[model samples]
Target: MTTVDATAIVVTHNSVSQVQDCLSALLSAGLPVRLIDNASTDGTPALVGARFPAVDLLVNDENVGFARAVNQGLAGVRTGSVLLVNPDCVLPPATARGLVEALRDRPEVGVVAPRLIARDGRVAVSAHPFESLTSVLGCQFGAALLPVPVRKLFSGRSRRRAYDACLRPGEPRTVDWVSGACLAVRTDLLLDLGGLDEGYFMYYEDEELCLRAWRRNAAVLYLPTVSATHVGGASSSPGQTWPHLYASRLRFFARHRPSTFGPVRLAVLLRALLGTALALARGLLRPGPAARRRVRAWREIYRIAAAADRTTLSQPVPMTSRSPSCT
Candidate 1:
């Protein structure tokens, strides 16, 4: 097999120092890196140019969202595999090599993700099942009722499974999907799947890509043996906290199930409405702050999901199956 020539793409804005630090880790990992600056006033371009002269840089005038910026950076990448890293995620020196090895050894794999450890050494959801409207509901709204372990079990995932397997050391193990942060994807496969769907500005774009890969009969691989620390939401703005993710969920809904806006979309809308009503009634009777907050948050999620249905009414979706309500 040929050795993979990976290109590391890092997107940056005002946090030039953080980006530089992140790039240091990637460089140490021994990969040719590309830096894409999305219209930052923080002198990130100047700092990166001066400090890492050999790095390829793209400077945009405005913050053109993560999907598009990374897509632009991807256009210049044509050789081997492509590893996309969030500027805030500091990868270990061994990470790049391990990820590349996993992808190289696993011919069936389309994307590979390393286990994500928090700075404090806790595993912070390294991977997730392919998200559907029901999967999102079960995890988001049902978290109180279904704890992490139970949730993973219901979702058909191995929580405590070892990352290394002697039998399938170089083989691809099927996973719901791999995460976007510090993910290594086969460059050609990514291109064939059309890379990141620009429709999704941030959230769920990686999942969308993996789903496309799934449709094309490619496997999403997760290697616990290879690890990286994803300081969660590192590049996102403060306003992007809960609200941004809630809004972005709609983008995901639209991309995966484009037929929602038609008669099928109305069915989803009605389901969401009925579910929200039941949640509100339960909360009102219970009279607790937690229940009330949960009800409100769930309302917002479904509202956005319904809205996304409206936005993509004209597009035609390929296929779908039965989905559960979020409430």
Candidate 2:
């Protein structure tokens, strides 16, 4: 009911409370909203349906990975702009209106990411370049191995990267990729790029989408002017998802940066292998529900990539989700 030429789609797993809170915050700020529940056994769909009767809901039988869920959610959005958001994110009172206003001036922008912060008040990961092997591995191994700044040429963990997109007391600037946690973009452009390349199961799908948009002569902007506090990874335990995250990373490397196909992919694979081995060595690990499903989801990505010519997704999307809960 808020005056805007846009409709938003938020995807959720089992985090019913977080999704509810997020919806309340978003609606209070006056944005038309819809939801796509990625098959939750814990009654997330029922709760959302009963509480927010005005929202358009798509309840799946099982979890479809993030990209597909977002694609499913987008189908019902009738407005000019479409937002892809996670259920764990709560928009600041001014965030929605500001983002809509920002979208108006930048018609060529395929996607825009807002300044994201953590609940503990730290800078959440937002507004970054393509998460290349060099970049991801740099974050893992050491900053010295690579020459250019890791996060951003200007903003690594240093004074520059840290403050480059800072929302504390200054203005926002544009960047290569905005975090997928809370991203808004034009509805038409999103469909044009095929709706987030389900090739990326969990992470880096945002990067893939933004980069594709960039190549299409569309800009991916980082607006520090508006902000959202994302209680990051509510659906996942950090330790468990690491492997799938790496797998998705490897798939990204294989699918995109083909020129560096040999050494670069090898480097990232080795790093991920080492990290997983170390994670195993530590023994403080648990495979949560999302992680377990992502294992299969990422595998599906690889399969989809391998059989690129064989598969044609012409029909409507299939609804899916896991029956088991997380650790």
Candidate 3:
């Protein structure tokens, strides 16, 4: 009986309980929603279909990655705006409306995201600046070896708080990109930009979309007035998490930074390669299951870097009992 101008898209993969809770919360917002299931082995599709029949459901034959699944959901949207909410995120009442209103109030903003709060009530880092080769290198594991003060001074991780718009909750501000956990984007602009690049199997696709929007002179804004609870990393296991992350990083850098032709970029690539190699060696010599997982993740990173392609690590690494599972 409620009404909202935007269409909501919720993408689920192996999300059992989280999908139900997310849908329950979204129902209060009163927006038409499309639930896209990427071959989830769990009962996510059945739960949504049985309990929330009003939702438009698209079940895939296999896990088609996050970007592609979201793109498929986007295709069903007839509204002026679309909201991308992860299965693990719960949006508050009127939260979706607030984002849509922001877009309506400001014609220049192509994307807007609400502040993401953890279940523990802590603000999550949702907004971030664009990635550069130097910034990426500074965020690698080797930076942890530096003195605390020195690392804080130079590492990109240190500036994460500064870039997070949630820290300044009173006012809405422009940002480079917001987390895809709960982002509202103009449907027209999203279509023009080809939705998310299917090349990004998982991470950084949101960043790439916002970055492209900026290039087209559209602003990406972060409105902290509204918030969503995001239980992060629900889809990934520890054994394969780092691999997907680093592989996506490699893809983003390759797609955006001309590493092969530019001298500065080439130097940055060399530093990342050497640093990853040293870390992988250290992880191998270390003891325990955690250490072995680190080794596996680092080896995947090294492989992606060597191949200079994200597709090299496209397949999900098999996770065993020893691997940490996200609840």
Candidate 4:
């Protein structure tokens, strides 16, 4: 067996229920772990200290968002590689070792992500080509809402093919980016890239990181042979994170693709408007708690998208100024 020289870094935010399992799996794999709790009010830090005493626990006074928290964890990493696994993800020792081995074998690959299996036992689509204007608009328009055939027609066959390739079990394939739910990356490469972009509060940080890695000539590899179970949306609910999702998407486009920023912004605004109208109709027609929640979420998304270039809801401090307090 290949000995894995990697420290697992899990950023937790009220992930009390999932962190136990997540840490257990990493420790069982004999990997040193560093967990950064983003001011989780549900006693997540206490639980980790009590249950997994060996884990280096870093507690934040406020929720610093995913990218920043991960950067905080990266600051103290002494390992050759770092595993950025979400608290909701559980991976076997072999899978973790395989990720490290992939990096060991391929000097050109900076990031390697395992195939993510959803809680329902379905292979999740974790890899994707870098976002273009059409892809961005397709996602903004909610391609998943349509049937598979119609979705291909609406979102383009390339998107469907990309998803299909990611879901299909095969050899390691090069991709634009992989989900951050579980990924292993070289420590030196990550630090050289200046860590994850702190501008992203929650979403799109993984994409931005991969984009930077590619810019630095480091290939992002997707390994289907290695798989992990990802309990998606453990820290926050979809309704609660919709605004952040759209805001991060706009921020990503504005920074990377300046020419398409205007179109992407317009698409986001239209999508938000459409969602708000639909949610309002649903709330009026149904008159239930769920419907009301949908209306509120959609309104928040619209508010964020309408803010022009300042789409991010909160201002993030520079990564250099922040450091994790390890215990």
Per-candidate TM equals 0.74, 0.78, 0.82, 0.92
**lDDT of candidate 4 over 1-327, digit per residue (tens):** 445799999999999999888999999999989898999999999999999999998898898889988988888678899999999999899999999999999999999999999889988888888898988776777765666557655555556665766666888888889999999999999988778888888999999889989999999999999899999998887787888898888888877777888888788878878887988888788889887777788888777777757434233435756575465
Cα lDDT, model 1, residue 172: 37
* Candidate 4 wrong stretches, greater than 4 Å: 147-161, 310-318
Residue 195 Cα positional deviation in candidate 2, in Å, after optimal superposition = 1.5
- Model with the higher lDDT, candidate 1 or 4: 4
Model 2, backbone clash pairs (residues 3+ apart or across chains), number: 6
lDDT of 3 at 292: 65
lDDT of each: 0.67, 0.67, 0.76, 0.85
Evaluate candidate 2 by giving its C-alpha RMSD to the native, one decimal: 6.5
Worst window of 10 by summed lDDT in candidate 1: 318-327
Tens digit per residue, CA lDDT, model 3, 79-104: 99999999899987678889999999
Per-prediction RMSD in angstroms? 8.4, 6.5, 7.0, 2.5
Error of 4 at 155 (Å): 5.5
Error of 3 at 62 (Å): 1.2
Backbone clash count for every predicted candidate, in the order shown = 1, 6, 0, 0
- lDDT (Cα, tens digit) per residue for candidate 1, span 1-327: 233478888888776757877888888766778787878898889998899877888887777667777777777476568898988788876778777877788788878877777778777665656555555554445543765556545553342232222112444356767678778888898777666766655667787778888888888877777678777765545333344465556556665555532444444445456656876788778878756665666566566656654456325332112111111
Encode model 2's per-residue lDDT on 166-229: one tens digit a residue. 5343665556777888888888887776676765557878887888788888887778777888
Instruction: In angstroms, give how far residue 205 of model 1 lies from its true place.
Output: 1.0
Global CA lDDT of candidate 1, please? 0.67
